[model samples]
Target: MNIIRNPKDVLSGLLFIALALLFGWQTADLPMGTAVRMGPGYFPLVLSGLLGLLGIIVVFNGLRTPGEMPTGIAWRALIIITFSVVFFGFAVRPLGFLPALGVAVFVSTLGSRLFRLQTALIITAVMVVFAWAVFIKGLGLPLPLLGPWLGGY
Candidate 1:
């Protein structure tokens, strides 16, 4: 019989379960009407249930298997990605789509070990164009193409 005592694994499993539950609860507000055409809630609800199930499996596996250790959390990458999201949210309205998206892409790439200045710039530019083409031209999301300097109003 294996005696499991990995605090990190237990905590992570619990956290995943909690997050899944939270997502499920929040998604409840979305309409889940017909089976033929699933409402917004359907996808999130299903995904959350799957996540919670996975969390349970993780916890059970940890309990059954001893000597299992959790990997170290990448705090720097986490912080950078988080801040990038925040930057995207704040900059989207004021700085407009292109600039905001560029910054977001660049900041997000910082999390990767292979990130370089030139690569980041290239990726940012490509992503910006892609966003403009897809969201603005294709979907007509009305995202501003130019920055405030050009008086995009």
Candidate 2:
């Protein structure tokens, strides 16, 4: 008999699939233009579809794998994450995207059991590059890359 040992992956996969379906259903009415000129809902729909695909893959992987049960929720980590998101929102305008993201990541890791400033800074730096590439370059978002404090944007 096939054992689905990784219950977490299975549950998360199902949840992601549900989310994708919801997103698709909600945006069904929106025009989905060609790849060259996408409609408002085009990106969301694509993202949802990709998420659904990943969910399916995760479910399959979970089915064949053995994994431990989930432990109790980390309340401190959760609170830190929530607050870091709030920090990011406030810091974005003043500090700009990269700086705000760095600060947010640095602050968020503080609540973790394995809090490491060096690791947080390293991760934040990597994410900054990724965020810059995805948001500013790939998505052509108009977020300020550098804030006024750094120099004239």
Q: Best candidate per TM-score, number?
A: 2
Best by lDDT: 2
lDDT per residue as tens, model 1, 44-99: 89889999998888777667666456678889899999999999888877788888
TM-scores for the candidates:
0.59, 0.77
Native-to-model Cα distance after best TM-score fit, residue 145 in candidate 2, in Å: 2.2
Residue 36 error, candidate 2, Å: 1.8
lDDT per model, in order?
Answer: 0.83, 0.87
- Residue pairs in steric clash, candidate 1? none
lDDT of 1: 0.83
Model 2 quality (TM-score): 0.77
